[model samples]
Target: MKNLVLGVNDAIYRACIGVAGLAIVIMALIIPWGVFSRYALGQGLGWPEPIAILLMVLFTFVGAAASYRAGAHMAVNALSDRLPPQVQPFLTLFVRLAMAAISLFMLVWGYKLCVATWNQYLSTLTWLRVGLSYAPIPLGGFITLLFVLEQLLYGDQHKRRVVDYECTEDSKEAV
Candidate 1:
């Protein structure tokens, strides 16, 4: 049972990170195209700006979840490190619980916001529902919730230092 749960959790983590990576890649390609089209080609495309914004939303939200799991979020490492080892575990749990609550709030309210605006369309992309734009909020919350629960149950997988988003020993075996 433990192995199965770990396997599933790891799979989800990988998928989220993969999607985040793809979003970044897409943004990298389009932004340059937008700039080139405006200056070099002398015909600026309107679609790329909005597309880039949407892609950015995906990148930030999805990447956030993966970063959270990897303990890569901007944290006060200096302060946390100053604390006694015995007190750190409980302090970490307290922080995780607080984060979990925030995630739940986002999940519930963000979905409501999405549904409320479902019938509306983007000013730029009229064919695209505004609701779609709001999807990343709840999605990010959901992913964070999963990661928080997994950490609570199995303990943090971020046992070693991770440099530049690369997987550590704990994460590599799962992949």
Candidate 2:
């Protein structure tokens, strides 16, 4: 079960990163193209701005899922590191479960928002609905929740053992 969750999450992470990177590349290329065309040729690349904004939105949320899988999200690890050796495991578990809960909640709520926005067409492009732009919310949240759950179940077992001062000969100072 753990492997299954990790496999799917990692797959999604890789795909999302690739798509988001492509979106950025497209935006970068198109913006310059639009500017150069308008200024040099006197004809506007009218589609670029709208397309760039759409891609930018995709990049933000897709990249967020990649960050979550890579454990690149912002966190304060200081307290966890300071925890006593015997308590570290529990602390780690707690943190993972907390993250999973939050991700799950977001997944549920984001799906609702996506559904609500489904029928509304984008202002700039009537052919494309706003739901298409916002679909990443539920998708990213689901991927993140899966990854965190996988880590909690399988990752902790593989962690390197840490030695603390209390477990070493330095503890003799108290006696």
Maximum-TM-score candidate:
1
List ranges where model 2 is wrong by over 4 Å. Answer: 1-5, 43-46, 156-175
* Tens-digit lDDT track of model 1 for 1-175: 6566666667787898899999888889999999999999999888888999998998888889889988899888686799999998988999999999998998999899999999999998888899999999999999999889988987887673323135557787877
Question: Between which residue pairs do clashes occur in model 1?
Answer: none
* Candidate lDDT values, in order: 0.86, 0.75
Cα error, candidate 1, residue 112 (Å): 1.1
| TM-score, every prediction | 0.86, 0.74
- The residue-by-residue lDDT of candidate 2 on 1-175, one tens digit each, is 5445555555676788899899999999999998999999999865788889988877877787677667676779899889899998888788888888888887898899888999998776778888777777777778777667667765832232222212435566555
